[model samples]
Target: MKLDEYLGVIIFTFEHMKDIPVHQLKDRANPAGFEIKYFSPGSMRKEMELLGDDVDDHYLGAHRDDHYLFFLLEKGNASLMIDFQTLPFGKNSLYYVLPGQVHHSIKNEIVYGWFIAVDTMLISTDYRNVFETQLKLQQPHLLDDKQLQQCKSILSLLLEKYDSDVKSSFYIPVVHSLLQSFIGMVACYYSQVNNTGMQLSRPLQLSQQFKQLLGRHIRTIKSPSAYAGMLNVSESYLNEALKKATGFSVSYWIAQEVVMEAKRLLYYSELNVKQIAHHLGYEDHTYFSRLFKKTANETPLEFRAQNRK
Candidate 1:
């Protein structure tokens, strides 16, 4: 099939993968740098009517957002494909999508929730650490009765502040403070579930740092020794720490990261194998294909063909 044909099919199914789009929520007039939106059964259709084509684009197709996205699903069911993995969001659960993670809604019906989009600068470092670094998978967390009541109270107050008409001097700060509280509550819940205590052991800390570095520099830096040098640890020591913390060697993670990214690109983009290889810092497309086959147990084309909707 032609690439455009492939795009249309994958646009709805993994088999017909196409180029992914990126969504952003930045407006110069909105100095608050955040937006709070409520969703219900008929709300999305109404939004499509009021907001026009942009709203449709927001709902359909695979796309990544430039800002952090959070959802508090209070009723009904919803699901989404994040980084090519399908995650189901049940009622009274909280789910977050980190910036730059490609995702698209797979299902949304009779849903009642508050959707939030906030700039990266607005999220404090500690909160970011909890949501971004500590909760790597970004899945849904079912809220207990107390937690649900707490979130509802905070959101009620926050929505009031967000829609307040009184233009006081501390208006924005108050809104932001309320928003921060809501985020902190959610962060605490996840932190407790993830068991990311206040103090991490030395080996786990090193492993966490190494994983973060691997995510950011994987395209340009692939050598285990190079990672060890960057972390200021010897190669043997780095491998030992990684194995202790994650039960995997440094090389295993490197290959895993590379293949995961490659799969994402292959399943979402129109890029050819050669271009994708070069995009991954491999000048030799042939070698990259070999590596992918070794790691994924299939050639690039085979994977694309097998997984595409």
Candidate 2:
């Protein structure tokens, strides 16, 4: 399918996935600026039964969405493709799909899960940072039984609040709090699983701060040293902290971030290579093209053409 057609399918899936009728929510005008869907094992099985053969043919195809997805699988198993990486998830595992990521639910073996998709604006920057930065480097966590129960409890509460009949002034705040708690729990698990008992340290904190700073200033401040100065640390010290925390040097991260942004602009925007380069703070377009090729193994035009969807 074409990009627009596939995006339409994604939109339809999100809008109709809730157990409740879509018109009810639309009539009430959702105040939370996001939608939450709950899928119990029974509900999932029923839906799959209803879909029948279409499930294998349609749901397995690759598609992209504009919202963030957080999935918790309490039982059963499934395989999924995120970007070009195929990941198989089993019972008691949690995974996330960020916006603009091309993903496909490759196969399911009686899977039972809860997936919540929220707009980027509704998610706190701190929680979003966990997914955007840390989770990108780590695989999905295989949640222990205890963690699974905790997450299930939170999701249950969220579902209850989401399906509540009474809509009060406090409804939105309550839902937001519940969502934040759920995301915070997942982030904690993700960090603990990835770090392998690594204690939080000054260098780790500095590394996180530098990443946040780099994200905000990437278009204007291209230099690692400038990022270091902004964080009130010397370039060498910042590099040391980042290396210890993330296993990559500061220059590597900056280049990676820049190339990622360039790829986004190329895929989503109508900008040409030179315009994208200039917008990304490169004075010399040829130099920017070379850098992109070095980092991405493809020229800007080639990447854009290949990833236009």
Candidate 3:
């Protein structure tokens, strides 16, 4: 996990997941774009021992994954740092890390859990909406006894399917079905906290769409009006809907997305301020520098220096 050599954020793809030293199914086919591994205290210790001097390179580092990551802890205590926020984990808890979000394991003390990573295409549209749009700030979801047991039972079955050496004609389909069931359970839990009911409102839907679009096009498209045009809504209407749904206007989120990426680049990449500004789609480096200072309260160089230290 050396961060200094990269010119941009380090992205861990599904292929990268396969090479993880702690992973159990190293010899088995992981199925396309899906991977699950069961970890316990002994297993974690053994993994660290196997890595020896290279342990630091594999664990306790920051990087972004290109797939959704889920954790279901049946016991013990753990914590994860995601996008700079420390999320605490305890007994019978569930946590999810969205794709492209920077995260690192903070601590895992005598932990027993299932770590599952799946591609975005595998997640149904409705479930993806619940994860990407409905939730404002994702935190650890503490499960009740019944919910915990249900999750455990399903994951147990999934583990069996995943670890099985026999591959039938329907193996992939069966595994996918089980994966959907597990993800549906997770989405249901999150939707309850969102309180948006079964059906999302139109304004909220628009805001969600706007956010998704902003994530994809922030570097190329910078104006609120441009986004509105692409979404077939007026700029003022988009602003109003975004304000109601997120308490922030489209412009604010656009700037935030840019600044967040800027922070990632400044800290993780070796690129200088001018190159970084250009990389982020700003032609004039001075303007980009001003925007970074205004949004992040520090010049790009200062931020890089502080974080590097």
Candidate 4:
């Protein structure tokens, strides 16, 4: 299939996957992190079967998207046999996968879970704005039976409201809110079980709240100080908190993340430079192009043409 055609199919499957009387959630990336569309597993068996080939149900291939795979395993604990050829399985293991992480599911294990795709949008605040233990999940981690039950409850609530036709408009926001809430719950559990005490850090809490707000308002606001003012904190305090939590300057992180969004639009979207610049909140295309080059080491036109070629 052609690229656009395939994307169309994936997009379609993603949007209506919940309406199909299956229990699955499939989402596409606007950039690399946003779950533009998703549905429950019960509403997506056929697509799962078809995509099982692309994703290969028992295979080791990586997801093409740059989002983390948040699987809430809800069944028998099967072993994942992986490696150069084949490897032995580990018992009673639950799985979480970040983008670019390597691993695969076990074959014929009949594992049940919810898969989520997160969109990488502009980050108007510092990268250090959040402190959930799950956010620090640099690698795949395991969830236990209790955590799995919590996740199932979250999904069940989502499917209950989202699957119905009378409340279609509220579906998207409800799902998005629930995903965030679910993450918050998982983060809380990770913090409690692990006794990490990382979530209680004042700086981390402020930083994460800022990050969530930034995700929601990336298009309009792009300044660290602006976020600080909005969040009722001084710019210096905000910057210090973020720096203490994430090790980078707030301004640098914001600019870099915003640039990442620009790259996504320029590469995956057909928007012109001016349009892309406007989409990213810049009035001048020249400035946006310059920022793009500064961050990515290539002019917008050159970057798009070379990569999209």
Candidate 4, which ten residues in sequence have the lowest lDDT sum? 1-10
User: Per-residue lDDT tens digits of candidate 1, residues 1-309?
Assistant: 111111111233433544556566774115678877666666546434543443222235676667788778888887777876888877898988887677776665567778778888888867766675441366689998788888988988888888776377788889999999988887888888776656767777777788778878988999999999999999999999888877889999899889888887887777889988998899999999999999989999999898764
Point out the worst 10-residue segment of candidate 1 by lDDT: 1-10
**What is the per-residue lDDT of model 4 for residues 108-134, given as tens digits with 9 covering 90 to 100?**
344344544444232112221222233
lDDT of model 3 at position 33: 54
Candidate lDDT values, in order: 0.74, 0.68, 0.73, 0.51
What number of clashing residue pairs does each candidate have, in the order they appear? 7, 0, 0, 22
Clashing pairs in 3: none
Residues 112-161, candidate 2: write the lDDT tens digits. Answer: 67777676777776666566655243477888888888898988998888
Specify the highest-lDDT model's number.
1
| Candidate 3: stretches off by over 4 Å | 1-29, 44-47, 54-60, 134-136
Q: Please, what are the lDDT tens digits per residue for candidate 3 over residues 42-105?
A: 6545434443442343233466666678888887887676655678888988988777676666
Candidate 2 — worst ten consecutive residues by lDDT sum? Answer: 1-10
- TM-score of every model? 0.85, 0.68, 0.85, 0.51
TM-score of 1: 0.85
